[model samples]
Target: MNYIALSYWHLAIASILILANGMISLWFRLGLEKTLAINVVRMLVQLSLIGFVLKFIFVQTSPLWTIALAVIMVLVAGREVAARLTTRLAGWWSYGIGTTTMFFISISTTLLAVAFVISPEPWFAPRYVLPLLGMVLGNTLSGISLGLETLITTLKRERTAIEARIALGHRRFEAIEQPVRQSLKTGMMPIINAMAASGIVSLPGMMTGQIMAGADPVEATKYQILIMFLIGGATATGTLLAVIASAFRLTDERARLRLDRLENAGSKNV
Candidate 1:
């Protein structure tokens, strides 16, 4: 398969669409032009930097570098998960739960895939591990953010009913059981819908990228299938961990509701 080369000039041309969107934003008084511009720049800088970093890592093929980068990515992603919460837990708990979940789920799942499934020359191959880890973490992060947000927001809204349940002899987990279930459902819905729509409604990003880069369609599909399953599994597990941990944090050994653990929902610290 032949690969077509793209230069920086091509990217400049492609960026015209973003410029047009910014223009439209300004014209419509959408107040999104500045945001659009800033985000475009951020995307360029971040992607460019990562490209260089990945190049260096791939050349070195060092487990140490790969593991270090993975840790950094997990920490950054964890902080981002916390930032997405409208009502976050006070202090480090806001980010700690999600971060820990992402690290365990993403790293473990990626390693299992690389070791048993793909089994690249080196199990810790940066090229395979980093991208797979990124995808797993990204999906897991989404599910967790949604689950935690829904759980927290719902707890605040349904505080009275939950407390009533508690007063009526229900345990902490029992009182908030409905909201927890709802949160889990909300968190898993995206991957569920995605799985449903993957072949017919859309081609997944990884599959599409593989095809574009001249991989055999069926081969790309097999990889995509593996990825989807991994993502679904990771997302569900991570979301469950985050929601359950949060629930525990929201209650004490005495089984009392502890809303004090949460920061204000409206005043986003980010």
Candidate 2:
């Protein structure tokens, strides 16, 4: 079967499902109408804009365009990860930690996949690199955000215990070791669960899309499996790096807990 193209009318018909959601919010007096409406508009606009932007880039052969988009994606992901944190390292450190780790992990993994695994003619081909980069970056951003949040929140809640450990001659790493481990685990759990449930309980988006596009099921599964493994490795490495970097920022040379270094971030009245 050939791939089917969706039109505006088709999109409108599909949106009826969201009305059901809006109805539930009304039934429960949940007052989610405004939020849902705003979010729907945001999603539509963002997705539409990207669709056009991608269409334009698809015809271009320049590696520069692909690289430029990759950089923008990283910066945006970095800001988003920082913004999602209830508490984060103050100033640029909040953005720096997540963005830096994600940039290295996601880009390197995508490059490796495109150059070695996929091996398309022009290695920097947008068709291959951008999707791989986007997937890896999105997953890595989640991992880094969760890991950073876990580290900062744990430090605040365990200030007394961490300090006591410090007084007992434990280094900063020793004092916060448990939180670090738990943070890495928390950061990695979503991907772990998804991988576990992938073939059994659900089909991943990439696999589904490929099959819909007429690729053989076996080939599609292979691609999805490759992407999943790359995402898993990137997520793990990015989470570890971001968590460790943020932990260092929240401690000092004297092995003291430095909760003062963190500040609540996100949209709020200053």
Candidate 3:
């Protein structure tokens, strides 16, 4: 079987769904019509650009270009993680932590997958490396962002409770243990739920794409399972790192809560 090509008319016709969604939002006074429209446009433009760029990079097949693109993806994901936080640590700490955690876990997982699991030719093949890195980084980005935000918000909301624990001789880590655990759990929930519902509720993107491209169903499913496991591990590692780092940032060496380190959520500037 051959993959069917979608033409301009096909895309234009498909876009009607988005327009209908926007219209529905407007009709209900949901205030999301503008956002929906803008997001649709952005998604179209970004995906188109990336499609062309990936084609070019795949043809070139240079590790340097592949690594550079991977770095760019991680950096952008890191920035997104930091931006999503309602309250953030002073200076570049928040952004740095996010970037570091994402880079470490995503890259490590990608390398392991490429080197040991998939083992594509050249090991750093643009086609395999880029997509795998993107998938891992994308999932990690969401997990880390959620974990960081949860930790920051919980620390601020429960500052008094945490301080009381500290005053009662509980270590800083002990005081914030529950919040940290909760944050990690919250961060991992999306991936976990997706895993649980994957085959039963809906098909995953990778498997769907592969099947559409005429791959064997069993082969596609095997690949999807591997990818899911990789994503889960990456998300868990990244979320743990982000939550723990944020927790430490929220306290001092003296085991006192350092809510001062956090900027107000609605503050104009950091």
Residue pairs whose backbone atoms clash in candidate 2: none
Give the per-residue lDDT digits (tens) of candidate 3, residues 1-270.
Answer: 799988999999887877788788889999998878787888889899999999999999999999889999989888888777878887788889999999999999999998889999998899899988888998998999888888888888888899899999999799999889989999999999999999999899989999999999999999999999999999999999888888888887889898888875546443
Q: Compose the digit string of candidate 2's lDDT tens values, residues 205-245.
A: 98999999999999999999999999999999999999888
Clashing pairs in 1: none
> What's the TM-score of each model vs. the native?
0.93, 0.93, 0.93
Question: By descending lDDT, how would the candidates be arranged?
Answer: 1, 3, 2
Off by more than 4 A, model 2 = 20-35, 267-270
lDDT of 1: 0.91
Candidate 3 stretches with Cα past 4 Å from truth are 24-30, 265-270
Report backbone clashes per prediction. 0, 0, 0
